[model samples]
Target: MSVELNHTIVHCRDNRESAEFLAHILGLSTGDEWGPFIPLVLANGVTLDFATIPAGSITVQHYAFLVSEAEFDTAFSRIEERGITYWADPHRKLPGRINHNDGGRGVYFPDPSGHGMELITRPYGGWPEGSPVVPGS
Candidate 1:
């Protein structure tokens, strides 16, 4: 059997807002209701289930997306257009910048719920030519 990730619940202060925020970033639409939460399904069929919770009761989580170089460019542009802060490193040492890690570009930012959102073309380790340093490297 081929196993694939389907969905995961994202506890947020406001489900609709969180869903919309993720949808906007990923260039997807806020999907219709599925039980008690709002969902944003990716092209890969992985849905982000956002559930509303009491204020100050939500915890921060990290979610990374492996995108193509072209998708990275487009998403980075969107991030910039929205004036959202971007960091080349996970520690947020170098702000407002992107990294050319593993011969590919990557960036990190936070979502509305304070969840760490990352976009990377390369995972880690060795990369091709002209690869940018993974900040602090």
Candidate 2:
């Protein structure tokens, strides 16, 4: 049997809003809420379970997604349509720009809960062909 990550809880100010926001960007649907969690499952079966926490208790978190070129285009359009600010780099110094790293596009933006969200078409440093650990490995 291979080990896999099933899910992770994302602490947010509002679970429903955060979950819905990500679901829309990824062109996915939110799953039914279970208790305090509002889950957004990815294609790999890894769920991002959003849970509400006090706004004061929330800290900055970074979430990155490896997306296809078409998916990136759609998501980036939504970001622009929503008037969300984005940057080519994580520090957000390069505003209104996108990065072509490893021959793929990437952008960084902040979610409503202030989480640093990233969408990239290629893995940093390129895909790991023989690394000990790859995504979903």
Best by lDDT: 2
Each prediction's whole-model lDDT (CA): 0.82, 0.87
lDDT of 2 at 40: 94
TM-score of each: 0.85, 0.90
Q: Find the number of clashing residue pairs for candidate 2.
A: 0
Alpha-carbon RMSD of each model: 3.6, 6.9
Question: Which candidate has the top score in TM-score?
Answer: 2
Query: How well is each residue in 93-133 modelled by candidate 2, as lDDT tens digits?
Result: 67888877777888888998999999998899953343222
| lDDT string, candidate 1, 17-80, tens digits | 8889878877779978777799988778898899998868888888888888788877887888
lDDT accuracy of residue 84 in candidate 1? 90
Model 1: residues >4 Å from true position, as ranges? 126-137
